[model samples]
Target: MHTSKLIKDTPTDRIFLFVLYIFIGLAVLIVLYPLIYIISASVSSPLAVNSGKMWLWPVGFNLDGYKVILQYGDIWRGYMMTIFYTISGTMVSLFITIPCAYAISRRDFAGKKWFTNFMLITMFLSGGLIPTYLLVRNLGMLNTVWAIIIPNAVSVYNIIVTKSFFQSTIPWEMQEAAKVDGASDFQIFFRIVLPLSAPIIAVMALFYGVGQWNDYFNSLVYLQNKNLYPLQMVLRQILVLQDMQQGSATGSTISQSAAQAAFSKEQLVAVIKYGVMIVSSLPVIMVYPLLQRYFVKGVLIGSLKG
Candidate 1:
């Protein structure tokens, strides 16, 4: 009887909960609406797309844009190159960051403080772009795939986050017990520490994977060979050229037929841009869900406790 009365008296709480859910629903819609519109516009005919006729659904369904973009062989090559870079770079980042973070997390290690300071300093300072470019040139990494992968192998922020997680979550008594059982430092770390640190590792993998997958600036700066270009650089080029082609060629002395042809080509290119985004980003986006399940737990567990 008391419980029933308490439940019945919670009208104010119910009202607040209803209002919170409504706000959350509205926020989700606001975030998802642009993505939905983009997907719809990509499939819609250029005439329907440009006239702002599209809403929640495609204005006129057409696959012409996708067909035109896929006809270009270089885009496929760029896709393959990007895949290689993202996978290889992520592996290198993990190799460098994991052990380094583990070492820093241990309080008793000699020179640990100095090492931590050195890493923190890097987070605050770097050789400017010109110096970095010169260094890459001197190393003969220019125009090669290595330029993109090697220079960014370890991110300082990621290292700090990883170290914090290890320190906060991993108990020292566990390490001592492993040592008592005749396990070497390497065995302790690999067999015990890493196996138990799945959440943080997943978080780091997602971070490194996303960074490598989306990287384009370094490729543009160092790589002169078009064959070595990542998907992002290729997409950027396509979008820029597409926009230029779209601008009015009316005042120019070009013939009427040429002007009309240019306009049509530009419209086609505009549609292709949206299609390219869908193609390039979809794979990376799909990977998020697998990693996302670990994100909240990883971040919460790994954060500094004191």
Candidate 2:
């Protein structure tokens, strides 16, 4: 007969584990409650949302918010614009970032130290908003899709992560052997390095794609045409109009008919705010799962390696 021994925690360890579990539970509640509330409020009747009657669950069920958003023409146009920006911008960023990081990762690349230090320094400091705006203006990129995609095309942190991945993961001997076999640098890089770098590439694409998808600040600042506005900008316009309506409803005296119209509009807007949250966030939430396997592996290998 085989004897078995079970390991058990002492009183002190059990108490510490209990406290940690309690803290973790509190943290989860803090993060989860807002998401629950937003979803509940989005589907609830406008009046219920406005009156705070909807809490953890929806009250006075209604689909008017979704109906309105779906019917809005500008919402669809902005949706297409956002998709264009995300795809084009991610392509541009990745193209610039990958080769630059690979170049800096190689020991034989001249002045690599100086270039790396320059990038690291830039990570700490930048020419602030005004100078950057002037630069973009001088480039004649304003009001164009270029403004959304060009100005912030490359991120230093991304370069660092990619450089780390290249340096730590790729064996220098492989390149040396390729060179000995009469393969050119470009040939070896394209044929071998890229094939092996799928995980990091996926990770980079996820990061850049998500960033571009959510970006509205660039559109708000650089774009003047309604047609050029992205989804977030279009949604922002709705939210702002709602705020203006609220101010007029409460602060300014109006006729009974006008007052009732404003009240109805305000209620609808309140529900729309929550509905928009779910809509805007849903894309990113859905995309993350597709790249999640590569995300953890890439980040860990790139970050943990010397």
- On lDDT, the candidate that comes out on top is 2
Error of 2 at 182 (Å): 0.6
Tens digit per residue, CA lDDT, model 2, 210-306: 8999999999889999899999998887667642456543113222322444447657778878888888888888878877887787668666543
Window of ten residues with lowest summed lDDT in model 2: 249-258
lDDT of 1 by residue, 1-306 (tens): 455434464789899999999999999999999888878878887777776777778977877677656755667889999999988999899999999999988866899889989988988899899999999999999999999999999988888888888887889889988899999999999998999888788788878888888999999899989899888888787777632345433212112322444435545555667888888788877877766777776567546652
RMSD of 2: 3.9
Indicate the residue-level lDDT of 208 in model 2. 92
lDDT, residue 206, model 1: 78
Model 2: colliding residue pairs:
none
Task: Return the TM-score for each candidate structure.
Answer: 0.85, 0.91
- Lowest lDDT sum, 10 consecutive residues, model 1, at 249-258
